[model samples]
Target: MDDTSRIGAAPRRAGDDVIQVHARLRSMILDCTLEPGSKVTQAELSRLTDAGRTPLREALRMLQQEGLVKAELNKRITIAAFDLDKLDCTYAYRISIEAAAIRVTASLLSTAEFDELDRTLVDMGEAIERRDRDEFEGPHRRFHQMLVSHVQEGARARMAIDADWAERVRRFVMQGDQHSLARADAEHREILEACRARDGVRASRLLASHLARSAFYVAAQLEPTYDTILTRTALRMVLGDELAQTAK
Candidate 1:
Protein backbone atom coordinates (compact mmCIF):
# COMPACT_ATOMS: atom_id res chain seq x y z
CA MET A 1 0.00 0.00 0.00
CA ASP A 2 1.17 3.57 -0.77
CA ASP A 3 1.44 6.33 1.83
CA THR A 4 -1.96 7.59 0.66
CA SER A 5 -3.47 4.16 1.20
CA ARG A 6 -1.93 4.04 4.64
CA ILE A 7 -3.45 7.39 5.51
CA GLY A 8 -6.79 6.31 4.04
CA ALA A 9 -6.79 3.45 6.52
CA ALA A 10 -8.02 5.97 9.05
CA PRO A 11 -11.18 7.48 7.61
CA ARG A 12 -11.26 10.55 9.88
CA ARG A 13 -7.60 11.43 9.29
CA ALA A 14 -8.06 11.04 5.56
CA GLY A 15 -11.02 13.39 5.63
CA ASP A 16 -8.98 16.04 7.43
CA ASP A 17 -6.19 15.68 4.87
CA VAL A 18 -8.66 16.28 2.06
CA ILE A 19 -9.92 19.48 3.63
CA GLN A 20 -6.42 20.82 4.29
CA VAL A 21 -5.26 20.03 0.76
CA HIS A 22 -8.38 21.66 -0.66
CA ALA A 23 -7.72 24.86 1.26
CA ARG A 24 -4.02 24.83 0.35
CA LEU A 25 -4.76 24.41 -3.34
CA ARG A 26 -7.44 27.08 -3.30
CA SER A 27 -5.12 29.57 -1.62
CA MET A 28 -2.29 28.81 -4.04
CA ILE A 29 -4.55 29.39 -7.03
CA LEU A 30 -6.01 32.63 -5.69
CA ASP A 31 -2.61 33.98 -4.73
CA CYS A 32 -1.36 33.32 -8.28
CA THR A 33 1.30 31.06 -6.81
CA LEU A 34 0.03 28.43 -9.24
CA GLU A 35 -0.38 30.99 -12.08
CA PRO A 36 -3.62 31.54 -13.95
CA GLY A 37 -4.31 29.59 -17.12
CA SER A 38 -1.29 27.38 -16.51
CA LYS A 39 -1.62 23.67 -17.15
CA VAL A 40 -0.48 21.60 -14.20
CA THR A 41 -0.13 17.87 -13.74
CA GLN A 42 -1.43 15.99 -10.72
CA ALA A 43 2.11 14.93 -9.87
CA GLU A 44 3.19 18.58 -9.78
CA LEU A 45 0.31 19.47 -7.46
CA SER A 46 0.93 16.54 -5.16
CA ARG A 47 4.55 17.59 -4.81
CA LEU A 48 3.71 21.27 -4.29
CA THR A 49 1.00 20.59 -1.72
CA ASP A 50 2.64 17.56 -0.13
CA ALA A 51 -0.64 15.80 -0.75
CA GLY A 52 -0.94 12.17 -1.82
CA ARG A 53 -2.93 11.08 -4.86
CA THR A 54 -6.20 10.36 -3.05
CA PRO A 55 -6.33 13.64 -1.14
CA LEU A 56 -5.08 15.67 -4.10
CA ARG A 57 -7.79 14.27 -6.35
CA GLU A 58 -10.45 15.02 -3.74
CA ALA A 59 -9.14 18.57 -3.29
CA LEU A 60 -9.06 19.15 -7.06
CA ARG A 61 -12.71 18.14 -7.20
CA MET A 62 -13.54 20.84 -4.67
CA LEU A 63 -11.61 23.46 -6.68
CA GLN A 64 -13.36 22.27 -9.83
CA GLN A 65 -16.70 22.81 -8.14
CA GLU A 66 -15.57 26.34 -7.28
CA GLY A 67 -14.70 26.87 -10.99
CA LEU A 68 -11.09 27.50 -10.11
CA VAL A 69 -9.69 24.67 -12.22
CA LYS A 70 -10.76 22.58 -15.19
CA ALA A 71 -10.10 18.86 -15.54
CA GLU A 72 -8.75 17.91 -18.94
CA LEU A 73 -8.94 14.86 -21.20
CA ASN A 74 -5.28 14.02 -20.64
CA LYS A 75 -5.59 14.55 -16.86
CA ARG A 76 -3.83 17.90 -16.58
CA ILE A 77 -5.83 20.67 -14.85
CA THR A 78 -6.15 24.19 -16.27
CA ILE A 79 -6.24 27.02 -13.80
CA ALA A 80 -8.94 29.56 -14.46
CA ALA A 81 -7.49 32.31 -16.65
CA PHE A 82 -7.79 35.95 -15.74
CA ASP A 83 -9.84 38.09 -18.09
CA LEU A 84 -10.99 41.70 -18.15
CA ASP A 85 -14.60 40.76 -18.82
CA LYS A 86 -14.66 38.33 -15.89
CA LEU A 87 -13.12 40.97 -13.67
CA ASP A 88 -15.95 43.39 -14.51
CA CYS A 89 -18.53 40.68 -13.91
CA THR A 90 -17.03 39.73 -10.58
CA TYR A 91 -16.92 43.34 -9.41
CA ALA A 92 -20.44 43.96 -10.67
CA TYR A 93 -21.74 41.05 -8.65
CA ARG A 94 -19.88 42.27 -5.59
CA ILE A 95 -21.20 45.81 -6.06
CA SER A 96 -24.80 44.62 -6.30
CA ILE A 97 -24.79 42.01 -3.54
CA GLU A 98 -22.55 43.81 -1.07
CA ALA A 99 -24.39 47.09 -1.55
CA ALA A 100 -27.74 45.50 -0.73
CA ALA A 101 -26.31 43.46 2.15
CA ILE A 102 -24.54 46.41 3.71
CA ARG A 103 -27.74 48.46 3.52
CA VAL A 104 -29.19 45.99 6.01
CA THR A 105 -25.90 45.34 7.77
CA ALA A 106 -25.08 48.99 8.38
CA SER A 107 -27.81 49.57 10.92
CA LEU A 108 -27.15 46.26 12.62
CA LEU A 109 -23.57 46.83 13.70
CA SER A 110 -22.98 46.96 17.45
CA THR A 111 -20.61 49.36 19.18
CA ALA A 112 -18.15 46.51 19.56
CA GLU A 113 -18.23 45.96 15.80
CA PHE A 114 -17.51 49.62 15.21
CA ASP A 115 -14.53 49.38 17.54
CA GLU A 116 -13.23 46.39 15.67
CA LEU A 117 -13.53 48.23 12.37
CA ASP A 118 -11.55 51.12 13.77
CA ARG A 119 -8.75 48.76 14.68
CA THR A 120 -8.72 47.31 11.18
CA LEU A 121 -8.38 50.78 9.74
CA VAL A 122 -5.41 51.39 12.03
CA ASP A 123 -3.85 48.12 10.96
CA MET A 124 -4.35 49.05 7.29
CA GLY A 125 -2.58 52.34 7.83
CA GLU A 126 0.38 50.55 9.38
CA ALA A 127 0.49 48.12 6.48
CA ILE A 128 0.47 51.00 4.04
CA GLU A 129 3.43 52.53 5.83
CA ARG A 130 5.28 49.26 5.54
CA ARG A 131 4.38 49.00 1.82
CA ASP A 132 3.30 45.43 2.43
CA ARG A 133 0.34 44.25 0.36
CA ASP A 134 0.11 40.95 2.20
CA GLU A 135 0.02 42.65 5.58
CA PHE A 136 -2.68 45.10 4.50
CA GLU A 137 -4.92 42.39 3.03
CA GLY A 138 -5.71 40.55 6.26
CA PRO A 139 -7.32 43.43 8.17
CA HIS A 140 -8.66 44.86 4.94
CA ARG A 141 -10.58 41.64 4.22
CA ARG A 142 -11.70 41.32 7.84
CA PHE A 143 -13.02 44.86 7.71
CA HIS A 144 -15.22 44.04 4.72
CA GLN A 145 -16.24 40.67 6.23
CA MET A 146 -17.45 42.36 9.36
CA LEU A 147 -19.66 44.69 7.33
CA VAL A 148 -21.80 41.80 6.14
CA SER A 149 -21.39 39.47 9.10
CA HIS A 150 -25.12 39.61 9.83
CA VAL A 151 -26.12 38.35 6.37
CA GLN A 152 -26.97 34.80 5.28
CA GLU A 153 -24.03 32.41 5.07
CA GLY A 154 -24.53 31.66 1.37
CA ALA A 155 -24.47 35.30 0.29
CA ARG A 156 -21.45 35.96 2.47
CA ALA A 157 -19.61 32.98 1.04
CA ARG A 158 -20.20 34.14 -2.54
CA MET A 159 -19.07 37.63 -1.67
CA ALA A 160 -15.92 36.23 0.00
CA ILE A 161 -14.95 34.36 -3.17
CA ASP A 162 -15.50 37.42 -5.32
CA ALA A 163 -13.51 39.51 -2.89
CA ASP A 164 -10.62 37.09 -3.12
CA TRP A 165 -10.68 37.33 -6.90
CA ALA A 166 -10.77 41.11 -6.79
CA GLU A 167 -7.81 41.22 -4.42
CA ARG A 168 -5.89 38.81 -6.59
CA VAL A 169 -6.43 40.97 -9.65
CA ARG A 170 -5.40 44.06 -7.73
CA ARG A 171 -2.19 42.41 -6.64
CA PHE A 172 -1.47 41.08 -10.11
CA VAL A 173 -2.02 44.39 -11.83
CA MET A 174 -1.98 47.77 -10.13
CA GLN A 175 1.17 48.78 -8.33
CA GLY A 176 -0.06 51.26 -5.76
CA ASP A 177 1.46 54.66 -5.26
CA GLN A 178 1.27 56.48 -1.93
CA HIS A 179 -1.39 58.81 -3.31
CA SER A 180 -3.67 55.94 -4.30
CA LEU A 181 -3.15 54.18 -0.98
CA ALA A 182 -4.11 57.33 0.89
CA ARG A 183 -7.21 57.72 -1.26
CA ALA A 184 -8.28 54.12 -0.57
CA ASP A 185 -7.70 54.56 3.15
CA ALA A 186 -9.87 57.66 3.10
CA GLU A 187 -12.62 55.83 1.25
CA HIS A 188 -12.67 53.03 3.81
CA ARG A 189 -13.00 55.58 6.61
CA GLU A 190 -15.85 57.31 4.81
CA ILE A 191 -17.75 54.05 4.40
CA LEU A 192 -17.19 53.15 8.03
CA GLU A 193 -18.53 56.54 9.07
CA ALA A 194 -21.73 55.99 7.11
CA CYS A 195 -22.21 52.61 8.76
CA ARG A 196 -21.49 54.13 12.15
CA ALA A 197 -24.16 56.75 11.53
CA ARG A 198 -26.60 53.93 10.74
CA ASP A 199 -27.35 55.45 7.35
CA GLY A 200 -27.85 52.33 5.26
CA VAL A 201 -28.66 54.16 2.05
CA ARG A 202 -25.51 56.27 2.24
CA ALA A 203 -23.45 53.31 3.32
CA SER A 204 -24.79 51.25 0.43
CA ARG A 205 -23.96 53.99 -2.04
CA LEU A 206 -20.45 54.39 -0.64
CA LEU A 207 -19.76 50.68 -0.77
CA ALA A 208 -21.03 50.42 -4.34
CA SER A 209 -19.00 53.42 -5.40
CA HIS A 210 -15.90 52.05 -3.71
CA LEU A 211 -16.19 48.70 -5.51
CA ALA A 212 -16.90 50.37 -8.84
CA ARG A 213 -13.86 52.62 -8.59
CA SER A 214 -11.57 49.71 -7.99
CA ALA A 215 -13.05 47.78 -10.92
CA PHE A 216 -12.74 50.71 -13.29
CA TYR A 217 -9.18 51.48 -12.26
CA VAL A 218 -8.03 47.89 -12.61
CA ALA A 219 -9.80 47.48 -15.96
CA ALA A 220 -8.22 50.64 -17.27
CA GLN A 221 -4.77 49.44 -16.31
CA LEU A 222 -5.20 46.18 -18.24
CA GLU A 223 -7.21 47.23 -21.29
CA PRO A 224 -8.36 50.80 -21.52
CA THR A 225 -10.77 49.99 -24.35
CA TYR A 226 -12.63 47.40 -22.34
CA ASP A 227 -15.65 49.19 -20.92
CA THR A 228 -16.81 47.79 -17.62
CA ILE A 229 -20.48 47.87 -18.57
CA LEU A 230 -21.66 45.36 -15.98
CA THR A 231 -19.82 47.07 -13.17
CA ARG A 232 -21.03 50.49 -14.32
CA THR A 233 -24.60 49.22 -14.54
CA ALA A 234 -24.46 47.71 -11.09
CA LEU A 235 -23.06 50.93 -9.64
CA ARG A 236 -25.81 52.90 -11.36
CA MET A 237 -28.39 50.54 -9.96
CA VAL A 238 -27.09 51.06 -6.44
CA LEU A 239 -26.35 54.74 -6.85
CA GLY A 240 -28.68 56.57 -9.21
CA ASP A 241 -27.51 57.98 -12.57
CA GLU A 242 -26.63 61.40 -11.19
CA LEU A 243 -24.47 60.02 -8.37
CA ALA A 244 -23.01 57.25 -10.52
CA GLN A 245 -21.98 59.83 -13.06
CA THR A 246 -20.12 61.68 -10.33
CA ALA A 247 -18.67 58.48 -8.81
CA LYS A 248 -16.41 57.72 -11.76
Candidate 2:
Protein backbone atom coordinates (compact mmCIF):
# COMPACT_ATOMS: atom_id res chain seq x y z
CA MET A 1 0.00 0.00 0.00
CA ASP A 2 2.12 2.91 -1.28
CA ASP A 3 5.53 1.48 -0.49
CA THR A 4 5.05 1.63 3.26
CA SER A 5 7.43 -1.26 3.94
CA ARG A 6 10.29 1.13 4.55
CA ILE A 7 8.41 3.50 6.83
CA GLY A 8 9.86 1.97 10.01
CA ALA A 9 13.55 1.38 9.52
CA ALA A 10 14.49 -0.18 12.84
CA PRO A 11 18.21 0.34 13.32
CA ARG A 12 20.64 -2.56 13.61
CA ARG A 13 24.36 -3.18 13.30
CA ALA A 14 25.27 -4.81 9.99
CA GLY A 15 27.67 -7.40 11.42
CA ASP A 16 25.38 -8.92 14.03
CA ASP A 17 23.71 -11.79 12.19
CA VAL A 18 20.74 -12.28 14.49
CA ILE A 19 19.97 -8.58 14.88
CA GLN A 20 20.31 -7.95 11.15
CA VAL A 21 18.11 -10.92 10.31
CA HIS A 22 15.60 -9.92 12.93
CA ALA A 23 15.47 -6.31 11.72
CA ARG A 24 15.04 -7.41 8.11
CA LEU A 25 12.21 -9.81 8.90
CA ARG A 26 10.58 -7.37 11.29
CA SER A 27 10.68 -4.65 8.60
CA MET A 28 9.07 -7.06 6.18
CA ILE A 29 6.27 -7.85 8.60
CA LEU A 30 5.66 -4.21 9.49
CA ASP A 31 5.76 -3.04 5.87
CA CYS A 32 3.41 -5.81 4.78
CA THR A 33 6.10 -7.35 2.60
CA LEU A 34 5.17 -10.33 4.64
CA GLU A 35 1.44 -9.65 4.53
CA PRO A 36 -0.51 -9.77 7.74
CA GLY A 37 -2.31 -13.03 8.56
CA SER A 38 -0.18 -14.89 6.03
CA LYS A 39 1.64 -18.05 6.99
CA VAL A 40 5.41 -17.90 6.79
CA THR A 41 7.75 -20.84 6.38
CA GLN A 42 11.22 -21.00 7.87
CA ALA A 43 12.85 -21.95 4.61
CA GLU A 44 11.05 -19.12 2.85
CA LEU A 45 12.44 -16.46 5.17
CA SER A 46 15.90 -17.98 5.03
CA ARG A 47 15.88 -17.82 1.23
CA LEU A 48 14.31 -14.38 1.09
CA THR A 49 16.90 -12.80 3.39
CA ASP A 50 19.77 -15.17 2.59
CA ALA A 51 20.29 -15.68 6.32
CA GLY A 52 21.53 -18.96 7.70
CA ARG A 53 19.21 -21.35 9.52
CA THR A 54 20.46 -20.56 13.02
CA PRO A 55 20.13 -16.82 12.62
CA LEU A 56 16.78 -17.13 10.89
CA ARG A 57 15.49 -19.32 13.68
CA GLU A 58 16.72 -16.91 16.29
CA ALA A 59 15.21 -13.96 14.49
CA LEU A 60 11.87 -15.70 14.14
CA ARG A 61 11.91 -16.55 17.84
CA MET A 62 12.53 -12.93 18.74
CA LEU A 63 9.79 -11.74 16.41
CA GLN A 64 7.45 -14.22 18.03
CA GLN A 65 8.19 -12.71 21.39
CA GLU A 66 7.51 -9.21 19.99
CA GLY A 67 4.05 -10.44 18.87
CA LEU A 68 4.79 -9.77 15.21
CA VAL A 69 5.25 -13.43 14.40
CA LYS A 70 3.05 -16.05 16.00
CA ALA A 71 3.90 -19.72 16.49
CA GLU A 72 1.12 -22.26 16.64
CA LEU A 73 1.05 -25.56 18.51
CA ASN A 74 1.04 -27.32 15.15
CA LYS A 75 4.38 -25.66 14.28
CA ARG A 76 2.77 -22.97 12.18
CA ILE A 77 4.15 -19.44 11.99
CA THR A 78 1.91 -16.56 10.99
CA ILE A 79 2.50 -12.86 10.54
CA ALA A 80 0.37 -10.87 12.94
CA ALA A 81 -2.48 -8.78 11.58
CA PHE A 82 -2.83 -4.99 11.51
CA ASP A 83 -5.95 -5.42 13.55
CA LEU A 84 -4.14 -6.04 16.83
CA ASP A 85 -3.61 -4.35 20.18
CA LYS A 86 0.13 -4.32 19.55
CA LEU A 87 -0.30 -1.05 17.66
CA ASP A 88 -2.34 0.40 20.49
CA CYS A 89 0.19 -0.61 23.13
CA THR A 90 3.06 0.58 20.97
CA TYR A 91 1.62 4.09 20.79
CA ALA A 92 0.70 4.08 24.47
CA TYR A 93 4.27 3.58 25.62
CA ARG A 94 5.76 5.39 22.65
CA ILE A 95 3.99 8.61 23.53
CA SER A 96 5.45 8.61 27.02
CA ILE A 97 8.91 7.36 26.13
CA GLU A 98 9.33 9.59 23.12
CA ALA A 99 8.24 12.62 25.04
CA ALA A 100 10.91 11.86 27.60
CA ALA A 101 13.41 11.29 24.81
CA ILE A 102 12.64 14.62 23.20
CA ARG A 103 13.01 16.33 26.54
CA VAL A 104 16.47 14.88 26.96
CA THR A 105 17.44 15.24 23.32
CA ALA A 106 16.33 18.83 22.97
CA SER A 107 18.35 19.78 26.00
CA LEU A 108 21.46 18.01 24.74
CA LEU A 109 21.80 18.64 21.00
CA SER A 110 24.95 20.41 19.80
CA THR A 111 24.52 23.39 17.50
CA ALA A 112 25.89 21.20 14.70
CA GLU A 113 23.33 18.49 15.48
CA PHE A 114 20.59 21.07 15.49
CA ASP A 115 21.67 22.07 11.99
CA GLU A 116 21.37 18.42 10.95
CA LEU A 117 17.77 18.44 12.15
CA ASP A 118 17.10 21.52 10.08
CA ARG A 119 18.45 19.72 7.00
CA THR A 120 16.04 16.83 7.51
CA LEU A 121 13.16 19.22 8.00
CA VAL A 122 14.03 20.92 4.75
CA ASP A 123 14.14 17.57 2.95
CA MET A 124 10.79 16.56 4.43
CA GLY A 125 9.18 19.81 3.41
CA GLU A 126 10.40 19.43 -0.16
CA ALA A 127 9.06 15.87 -0.27
CA ILE A 128 5.68 16.99 0.93
CA GLU A 129 5.67 19.72 -1.67
CA ARG A 130 6.20 17.14 -4.35
CA ARG A 131 3.68 14.76 -2.79
CA ASP A 132 6.33 12.07 -3.01
CA ARG A 133 5.86 9.42 -0.33
CA ASP A 134 9.06 7.61 -1.26
CA GLU A 135 11.15 10.75 -0.96
CA PHE A 136 9.46 11.71 2.28
CA GLU A 137 9.90 8.37 4.04
CA GLY A 138 13.70 8.48 4.30
CA PRO A 139 14.05 11.94 5.82
CA HIS A 140 10.91 11.45 7.84
CA ARG A 141 12.36 8.33 9.40
CA ARG A 142 15.70 10.03 9.88
CA PHE A 143 14.02 13.05 11.40
CA HIS A 144 12.55 10.85 14.11
CA GLN A 145 15.83 9.02 14.71
CA MET A 146 17.59 12.36 14.96
CA LEU A 147 15.03 13.54 17.48
CA VAL A 148 15.78 10.74 19.95
CA SER A 149 19.46 10.11 19.17
CA HIS A 150 20.68 12.10 22.13
CA VAL A 151 18.95 9.75 24.56
CA GLN A 152 20.56 6.59 25.88
CA GLU A 153 21.17 3.90 23.26
CA GLY A 154 18.62 1.54 24.79
CA ALA A 155 15.96 4.20 24.74
CA ARG A 156 16.96 5.23 21.20
CA ALA A 157 16.52 1.67 19.98
CA ARG A 158 13.09 1.30 21.56
CA MET A 159 11.93 4.68 20.24
CA ALA A 160 13.13 3.82 16.74
CA ILE A 161 11.27 0.50 16.70
CA ASP A 162 8.14 1.79 18.41
CA ALA A 163 8.00 4.88 16.22
CA ASP A 164 8.21 2.75 13.13
CA TRP A 165 5.40 0.54 14.36
CA ALA A 166 3.32 3.59 15.20
CA GLU A 167 4.01 5.12 11.78
CA ARG A 168 2.87 1.94 10.05
CA VAL A 169 -0.37 1.87 12.00
CA ARG A 170 -0.88 5.56 11.29
CA ARG A 171 -0.49 4.97 7.56
CA PHE A 172 -3.03 2.16 7.81
CA VAL A 173 -5.51 4.53 9.40
CA MET A 174 -4.68 7.89 7.75
CA GLN A 175 -4.12 6.66 4.19
CA GLY A 176 -1.39 9.26 3.60
CA ASP A 177 -3.44 12.36 3.48
CA GLN A 178 -1.47 15.26 2.04
CA HIS A 179 -3.38 17.53 4.35
CA SER A 180 -1.87 15.76 7.32
CA LEU A 181 1.52 16.49 5.85
CA ALA A 182 0.73 20.17 6.20
CA ARG A 183 -0.20 19.69 9.81
CA ALA A 184 2.96 17.67 10.38
CA ASP A 185 5.10 20.39 8.85
CA ALA A 186 3.58 22.94 11.19
CA GLU A 187 3.85 20.73 14.27
CA HIS A 188 7.39 19.62 13.53
CA ARG A 189 8.46 23.22 13.07
CA GLU A 190 7.03 24.04 16.48
CA ILE A 191 8.79 21.03 18.01
CA LEU A 192 12.12 22.11 16.59
CA GLU A 193 11.52 25.65 17.69
CA ALA A 194 11.03 24.40 21.22
CA CYS A 195 14.30 22.54 20.95
CA ARG A 196 16.01 25.65 19.59
CA ALA A 197 14.89 27.58 22.61
CA ARG A 198 16.22 24.73 24.80
CA ASP A 199 12.93 24.46 26.60
CA GLY A 200 12.74 20.81 27.63
CA VAL A 201 9.42 21.14 29.35
CA ARG A 202 7.80 22.82 26.37
CA ALA A 203 9.32 20.31 23.96
CA SER A 204 8.15 17.38 26.04
CA ARG A 205 4.66 18.77 26.36
CA LEU A 206 4.48 19.42 22.62
CA LEU A 207 5.63 15.92 21.86
CA ALA A 208 2.95 14.48 24.12
CA SER A 209 0.27 16.59 22.56
CA HIS A 210 1.44 15.65 19.08
CA LEU A 211 1.04 11.95 19.82
CA ALA A 212 -2.20 12.40 21.70
CA ARG A 213 -3.66 14.36 18.81
CA SER A 214 -2.96 11.54 16.42
CA ALA A 215 -4.45 8.97 18.81
CA PHE A 216 -7.63 10.95 19.22
CA TYR A 217 -7.93 11.50 15.47
CA VAL A 218 -7.46 7.80 14.75
CA ALA A 219 -9.93 6.82 17.45
CA ALA A 220 -12.58 9.02 15.92
CA GLN A 221 -12.15 7.38 12.53
CA LEU A 222 -12.12 3.76 13.71
CA GLU A 223 -15.39 1.90 13.45
CA PRO A 224 -17.15 0.68 16.58
CA THR A 225 -16.01 -2.90 16.01
CA TYR A 226 -12.34 -2.15 16.48
CA ASP A 227 -10.85 -3.14 19.86
CA THR A 228 -8.96 0.06 20.67
CA ILE A 229 -8.74 2.35 23.67
CA LEU A 230 -11.10 4.87 22.25
CA THR A 231 -12.57 4.21 25.66
CA ARG A 232 -11.83 6.94 28.22
CA THR A 233 -9.44 5.11 30.53
CA ALA A 234 -6.99 3.79 27.94
CA LEU A 235 -7.15 7.04 26.00
CA ARG A 236 -6.26 9.09 29.04
CA MET A 237 -3.24 6.98 29.83
CA VAL A 238 -1.82 7.46 26.36
CA LEU A 239 -2.93 11.06 26.04
CA GLY A 240 -1.56 11.89 29.50
CA ASP A 241 -3.88 12.50 32.42
CA GLU A 242 -3.54 16.28 32.32
CA LEU A 243 -4.04 16.51 28.57
CA ALA A 244 -7.05 14.19 28.82
CA GLN A 245 -8.69 16.44 31.35
CA THR A 246 -7.94 19.52 29.25
CA ALA A 247 -9.57 17.90 26.21
CA LYS A 248 -12.84 17.47 28.07
The number of the candidate with the highest TM-score is 1
The C-alpha lDDT values of all candidates are 0.85, 0.72
- Which regions of candidate 1 fall more than 4 Å away from where they truly are? 1-20, 83-86, 127-135, 149-167, 170-183, 221-223
TM-score against truth, every candidate: 0.75, 0.64
The lowest-lDDT stretch of 10 consecutive residues in candidate 2 is 169-178
Tell me which residue pairs clash in candidate 1.
none
The predictions' CA RMSDs to the true structure, in order, are 5.2, 9.8
Collision count of model 2: 0
* Candidate with the greatest lDDT versus the true structure: 1
